[model samples]
Target: MTEQKTPPPPQIWPTLRAADARALIRFLVTAFGFEETVTYGDGDRVDHCQLSWPPGGGLMLGSVRDETDDAWALQPGTFGAYVVTDEPDKLAERARAAGAVIVKEPFDTDYGSRDFAARDPEGNLWAFGTYRGEPR
Candidate 1:
């Protein structure tokens, strides 16, 4: 048998700001199966958080702040990301059960990917699919 190598941890993190960071975090965890790895800040203001996708990548996020308060002024509800998954159908079902808005049902892409799109409670667009992206 051939040996397999473990992939390195993700270095590039997709980040977003949420108006209701705590609730958004909960929704992401419950609706999409993102693991809540770490969270900072007190009360409802999430200064920083890392939600790890079980499949080997993760994302960073924080509470929204005014432009004057934070240099990264990413607006809530304006973020979008595509997540790779092996089971888009089951994931979509789970998302729907958790009340995620289905923007697009599972479909086959021309390039041979099974994908589906949904909107998070914060209005961020999340596409889950079987595409692992082109080899680097």
Candidate 2:
């Protein structure tokens, strides 16, 4: 049998703030298939959380707090990100079935990539596509 290697942890982490962090996390997992790695906080307030995309990379999020209470004051519903996926159509279907709002239907791009866009419950725009970026 061949050996398998685990990919290294993501170096850059996209971050966001949510009015209802717990609910946002649930929606992300149920709709987009993000893996909830860890969460910290008390009650409904999420101080910090990490959700990992299966393909690679991940994102961090926390509950929205008053600007005076926290130094990083990211407003809810103001985050956007593009994620690479091999099956945008299938993912879009899953996301739709999970009550995600499909902002853009699955379509082919002129640059040779399948893509789709959706909005989570908190109104974060997420774009899923097959373009893995240009070669480094």
Candidate 3:
């Protein structure tokens, strides 16, 4: 397989903080087809959770400790996730219905993609697009 980004530690972990981490995980799994790989927490309070996709890649989720630890903190329009999908429009719609804030409307790009962007609840931006490059 072609190497990309040093290959994750068997996973491409992106941190996510939500009011309901479980719900978010459920939504990701059920709606987006992610599988719960490893979850670490207590009493429904998740300190850290891992979710993996079938083909490859995984996302990391955790609880926000509202003290001095700002790692889990999210600011308005601050986070971003670039996801390549066969149907950008559909994914954007799903994201919108799932309460994601649509940042940029779908449009064609000179870089070779028809894409759109959305911001998740924790301020992370998710981008959907088909970036087809010229054959090497």
Best by lDDT: 2
* Full ranking by lDDT: 2, 1, 3
Write one digit per residue (lDDT tens) for candidate 2, span 1-136: 5553543444789999999999999999999999999999999999999999998889999999999988999999999999989999999999999999999999999999999999999999999998877633
Q: Candidate 3: which stretches are off by over 4 Å?
A: 1-11, 30-33, 66-78, 132-136
TM-score of each: 0.91, 0.91, 0.67
* CA lDDT of each prediction against the hidden true structure: 0.93, 0.93, 0.69
Q: Worst ten-residue run, lDDT, model 1? A: 1-10
Model 3 — TM-score against the truth? 0.67
Off by over 4 Å in 2: 1-10
Against the correct fold, how does model 1 do in TM-score? 0.91
Pairs with backbone N, CA or C atoms under 3 Å apart (clashes), candidate 1:
none
lDDT for each residue of candidate 1 in 20-123, tens digit (9 for 90 to 100): 99999999999999999999999999999999999778899999997997989999999999998999999999999999999999999999999999999989
Query: What's the distance in Å from true for residue 109, model 2?
Result: 0.6
In candidate 3, what residue range of length 10 has the lowest lDDT sum? Answer: 3-12
Model 3, 1-136: lDDT tens digits are 6645442433356666666677777766654456899988887677889888555666788665574667557533344676657787887777677776788988999887999987665566677687633333
Question: Where in model 1 is the C-alpha error above 4 Å?
Answer: 1-10
RMSD in angstroms between candidate 3 and the native structure over all alpha carbons: 4.6
